[model samples]
Target: MECAAKGLAGEPCAGVAQRRCGSCGAVAYCSKDHQFVHWRFHKEECARLATQMSRIDVLSQFPFTFSVEPLALNHTLPSMRCLFLESIKVHLKGLWKPECICGPEIASVKDLSITAEWNMESSLCPCTEPENPVTRPLASWEDYYQWRSLPLHSPVAVLLHWPLTLYHCLQLSRIQTSRHDGHATLNIHYLGPEKELLQLAVFAELLALFPGVHLRIELVGPAVPRSRDGEVVNISSYAHCSVQNCGCRSSTAPEDLNSSAVTLKLWKGLYHERYSDIAKDSNPHLVLAPNAGVAAYPSWMPTIEMIREIGIPAIFTDFCEEAAHLASCCISYITGQPLGVPIQINPFRQPIAENNSALYIPCYSNCFVFGM
Candidate 1:
């Protein structure tokens, strides 16, 4: 771990952090002097961090096999990056590059839209309403798996976070789920989608989560390919395992495209740049940004301002408490108001820890969530 203290030049100290804070255990220092030097800034979050760390058991619970491993023991394992690569059967040598080092031109965007060639027929469809649908809140991955009748060993650990995070946001917002006429409709604006573009099928779980609610999610982000801009994906059925004897597939036929339960629209630009056009079609009831590095990205300022002006309830998740705190500060600064929703541990956060974090904090995808 790296020291949280700053050096004389106002940069993060380049010393090894072996001394962890006793109260919070979320930050570390190289020495007592450095700890004393950082106390002024760290004092603000010490108690909050301590409170969060106290509930480590609940926060760390997940159904994934790797969930049993302690995040603090990250040093013992080969790295989260290596684990992920092994899970997906990708080579570690030159095959994987977490971040793009080359210019944008070399990283050409591919068509991320779903097509008929995907062979949706081979996949199980959990489209029909269950004989006894789940009405209670699902508090954990195990809860969801039990409700959905999914085996614990299902290979959905990584991609399930997207839909689970969305569900958590909806729960935190307390959005009305009552049906009207025949079905209720919920519109969500998903900002800054990246890898999610390739795994949209996983979101079909929302159909099962909100039984009678029709979901329309508009994915707006720079990561959307230009070719797929304005493209619409209609998920008429929930995605299920293709295993022959899984026993969770629905017998009902797929619904017509026009009457799909979940619909996704893609936009290929920053949220603020295209919010006008997007809102003209359908105003969102809630906005979601998973792993949004609000403090690190200046472009988020415009989006924050727009969300505030429009008075939309927007939720954001960050990798760690420090990041969430910084993001909360950024949102407060941009909106000139205190956060409407305070940061808390996301129950459905990805079980895998992030390996690149410099601090001793338990960093994971969608680790902490807050709203404005």
Candidate 2:
């Protein structure tokens, strides 16, 4: 469209447009002075327009085509019968290992109902509002902290405050926003081997999908080599940090999607590889740990901490449900119960679940969160 700039000097800009508003791109300007004059009204309009554009962009990716009744208590893609139904059934659906978590009642893989409302839908945030309304570009953490002095929302709003689980936000591309009240904890169990691979895979996944997000890591647990091979430090080993030695935490965001970091040139790295022998694609969006050593996090700390620390944690362990019998037994550690509890509490109490036993969390591992 032509420039809409008009002024007392001569006339509205019927001239060829020279520039567009950098933020909204809705209006064109033939001259900078005209833009300045129009700024009084255009600024608010620009904010609204930008927000609307962002909403449209977000929805184009995640349409609410699949919303079932009696929503599943657990909210994650791994449990959401959409993307991972078959994957869980095939790779993870094994007989319940008696020692998996705990069970006053029977805890079966079948408890996670295949029939549940799994898709996301559009809705206004359920948080209380200040005189000023909240705008958008999907500020999850901001909303969580805003209205800090206000009373908490109901239990339901607290759970639904931020629904950016790896399964939902990263893999499934579904996210909805709401006001926050209380905190929700995430329990990321790094069960089985491949701990390093899984950790790197998670980091890389976050990097690939959410490069703008920050990743903060606290290295606990003793460093173990990837295998019996040699004494190469595991990626989880704080040795990977540019710093020297123990008690180290690194705050890193995924490499910017547009920027390139170091080249492994994997012969080995997560995104960069030195393996000239192997074919390579351009640097990937994911962060790959160099090839060689990968090990597990300490059982005490669990991998859940790492994921929650990645960005704003969203998914919680066991859907935060309380069993009729296990109320007193429930602990406040938040990452569900600690790694080595006898029974994997909350979700086990659920009649049907999308998560796994505490001992063996398949889809559960991916859906981690940070509590307020």
lDDT of 2 by residue, 1-372 (tens): 455455532666646666778886556677887777778867766764454334323222211222212354564443343322232221122111111222112212223211111121111222111233324333332343242222222111212212223223222213322111221111121112222321221122222223223332211122222232111111111112112221222334233412311111111111111212122322111111111111121231323343324333222232221221122122224344432212222211112223322211112221222121
Which ten contiguous residues of candidate 2 have the minimum total lDDT?
Answer: 113-122
Q: Mind giving the per-residue lDDT tens digits that candidate 1 earns over 25-133? A: 9778878878888898889989887865676676566665543233444454355455454444332321122212221231264544332111112322232344457
Clashes of each: 0, 21
Worst 10 residues of 1 by lDDT: 94-103
Badly placed stretches (over 4 Å) of model 2 are 1-199, 208-316, 323-372
Q: Candidate 1, which segments miss by more than 4 Å at Cα?
A: 5-25, 28-55, 63-78, 84-109, 114-131, 177-183, 240-253
TM-score, structure 1 vs. true:
0.76
**Clashing residue pairs, backbone N/CA/C < 3 A, model 1:** none
The most accurate candidate by lDDT is 1
